[model samples]
Target: MSGGVDSAVAAARAVEAGHEVVGVHLALSRMPGTLRTGSRGCCTIEDSMDARRAAAKLGIPFYVWDFSERFRADVVDDFVAEYAAGRTPNPCMRCNERIKFAALLDKALALGFDAVVTGHYAEVRQGPDGVELHRAAAWAKDQSYVLGVLTAEQLAHSWFPLGATPSKAEVRAEAEARGLSVAAKPDSHDICFIPDGDTRGWLASRVGAEEGAILDRSGERIGTHPGAAAFTVGQRKGLNIGYPSPDGRPRFVLEVRPKTNEVVVGPKEALAISELAGARFSWAGAAPADAASGFDCEVQVRAHADPVPATARLEDGELVIRVEEPIEGVAPGQTAVVYVGTRVVGQCTIDRTVSAVPASR
Candidate 1:
């Protein structure tokens, strides 16, 4: 339940629907000390206790499952590896893909459960063809972007009780009406493993810093940085480069070349990308029939970002997205979610980007 108002109210709704619901809280860290920080993170001991209390209030059985080993191997290790390869990754999506839907759902099914339910703000509906994933009614809280990794089989066995809710405030109100203590619990904002949200600091400790040169588009050594892996595409702050352009224009990170150990910086125009190629593509339901010829859709690169008009196609085992308008800040290893109207079509891990400026690198 994540010990949040959304999940508590979701559990209440499930109970009111007359389904047998059991609350399962994932213990994602082996070290108890890691969870001592409490509700600031999803996997905290305080969260587990709050989930237990909510389960008690709902009169449902509760259990804490230890998935720490698998989580570290899959989510944590993948995050480190992606950064080391000079790509920024969304670990939450990885967790949903590898741990929650794959591992947890498999175990739940083996235990005779029909479906795995969560409080995610996304919808799963039975369409004419099959199951389809859609954005939540609450547009601001829509999480279909992260859930895009789910395959058709996984989507078939998933339920989101809070998907139809109009807003998070309504969920909190429902929790209060249900007499749940976590009605006012703050939402977990930081990455679960990264309690303090210091991603750069945490990454530096794991991936040791290596001094590298920051080169301008013209191959001039404009500055130096601690490591290429520490920066992301389109990043403007913390470059520590004292020099400014002759025209006084600010420079932004255009690329991180891990193999060359170089951080490439340039003017903002260099970040304008028009196309993206991605690997590890997964469809929520059925693969589009015209996938090879390209179909019109909207592409979302980051969670909470606006979806842009685009043409998406699968070619030679890779998904290619061509946006109608050039966008900025697209980075490798990030997910590119595709949608037709409000229905989630599919997603893939961005592998390469084609920018309007040749010097973008």
Candidate 2:
């Protein structure tokens, strides 16, 4: 439990189902103050306390597992490195992929635990071949996109007690009825490691800010940026360009080059991307038999972004995705979660992209 309503309710349901349950809250931060308060970030001292109280109410054993070092190495350092390489990465996805499922699940299995149960809003179903991951019943509260990283083995040993719940409101209500104190606790947001919500400021301190040139689509230098690593593709607020576009349109960040310390800005239309591909990939449960022959699917990049119709196939040891419509502001380092109907089939960390708009145009 994150000392939140969802996880507390999830644990309550697990215990209610007549299974022996243990409430394990991960201590992910060595320095707790770095975790912000007031609905911004999680893993705080207050959150742990809340979790312990909920466990006491549920009459289960509660323990705080120290995963600080592993979390820092896998999620925190990876975030810094990805930003320094000028790629926008989702640290939550990395946490789910590396720490939560891989490291945590591995440890749980070694301890003879059947599965690592959590409060994620996703479903696990027994398929004909094996267990498969699917979206929650409600699309609005579905989180299968992040859980898309789970392999067949991981899915087999995972449980989401609240997956079939209708809505978050109902979870909160259940928590309240169960006498759980965290029934109304605000959901966490932003990067947990960053105390404040200012990501660019936090990155500048670690990556070491240095001035860099901001160029337009036609290779025209328009302005300078405080740091190349601080900007991400699709960002529009902080460009600080001196002049406006000829058509008086707002320009978005098209690219960031950390090697040369350059930020590329262009009209929003140039952000349209036709294709994305990645070398690092994994399937949810079963690999598509026709993956080499190309198969129809849907791709989602962000946590809440709508899925787009696409075709996926393996080519030269990479997962290549071709979307039916143009995707805007797609950059390298984002994970593309592919779906066939409601089930999560596979995912890939995007390594490259092909733009729909020509450079000169």
lDDT of each: 0.91, 0.91
Candidate 2 worst ten-residue window by lDDT: 31-40
Candidate 1 C-alpha lDDT tens digits along 1-361? 7788888888888889999999999999988665436667687888888999999999999999989999999999999999999998999999999999999999999999999899999999998879999999999999999999999999999999999999999888888888999988888766788766787888899987888999988888988999787899989998999878777999999889999899988989899999998878989998898999999999999998999999999889899999999999999999999999999999999999998878734
RMSD (Cα, Å) for all candidates, in order, is 1.4, 0.9
Off by over 4 Å in 1: none
> What are the per-residue Cα lDDT tens digits for candidate 2 across 1-361?
7888888888898899988888989899877577776666887888889999999999999999888999999999999999999999999999998888999889888988888889999999998878899999878999999898889999999999888988988998888899998888888888888887889899999998999899998888999999999998999998899789888999899999999999999989899999999999999998998999999999998989999999999999999999999999788999999999999999999999999999988
On the 0 to 100 scale, the lDDT of residue 239 in model 2 is: 89
Q: How close is every model to the real structure, measured as TM-score?
A: 0.97, 0.98
Candidate number of the best TM-score: 2
Q: Count the backbone clashes (under 3 Å) in each candidate.
A: 0, 0
CA lDDT of 134 in candidate 1?
99
Judged by lDDT against the true structure, how good is candidate 2? 0.91
